[model samples]
Target: MPARYFTLEEANALLPELEPVMAELLARRAKVVRQRHKIAPILDDPHGDMGGAAATEMALDFVRITELVEQVQAFGCLLKDLNTGLLDFLSERDGREVYLCWRYGEPRIEYYHELHTGFTGRQRY
Candidate 1:
């Protein structure tokens, strides 16, 4: 697919909708993590069947995570991290494609990086 290049204003404007979805994604991810910890012993057992409750919750968590991820992608943005709620909107600057980075709690989209540089290369928007 052609890249969806968002302007700074367009990226920031998506926050109201994106923030809540990111929040829910983080919450569901945390639940999955905690549930995995709780079931680690059972999972380690060679022939262990994950008990009904844990299995059910794990399945639910996976399904919910998938749904939340799809919602985020429907915005034509990349979800970088669920735990930290990092997102990147494909954008163009100075004649090149870059990512406009936003974390969960930031007031607005204020950082960006080259496509190959990743988060550590974030520059002020």
Candidate 2:
């Protein structure tokens, strides 16, 4: 699919929907991390089943993560960082393509960055 450029208001409008998904994504990610830690010792054992129950839960968490990510992308923004819940909505700036950057917990979109740069390059717009 082609990139969908978003005006500032359009991007902000999606926040209500986007916030819950991000929250869910973050929660699932935390589960995966905790489950992995619980199963870490088993993972080192060559003959271990890797703690079957915990492993299955972790696998399911991964699937849910993928679905949550796809859901966000379907809204026409790029999911940049799963760990930080970062996203970038494509937009034009000064006649050139740029990203309208957003992160989890922010009240609204307040920053942007050049295409070649990522979150670290975020700038107030």
Stretches of model 2 off by over 4 angstroms after superposition: 46-49
Worst 10 residues of 1 by lDDT: 43-52
Looking at candidate 2, the ten consecutive residues that score lowest on lDDT are 50-59
Candidate 2 per-residue lDDT over residues 1-125, each given as its tens digit: 77799998999999999999999999999888888878999889999996788888888889999999999989999999989999999999899999999999999999999999898899998
Query: Which residue runs of candidate 1 sit more than 4 Å off their true CA positions?
Result: 44-49
Error of 1 at 49 (Å): 5.5
List the candidates' TM-scores in order.
Answer: 0.92, 0.93
Q: What is the C-alpha RMSD of each candidate to the true structure, in Å?
A: 1.6, 1.3
TM-score of 2: 0.93
lDDT of 1 by residue, 10-51 (tens): 999999999899888998898888888888898788788855
Model 1 scores a C-alpha lDDT of 0.91
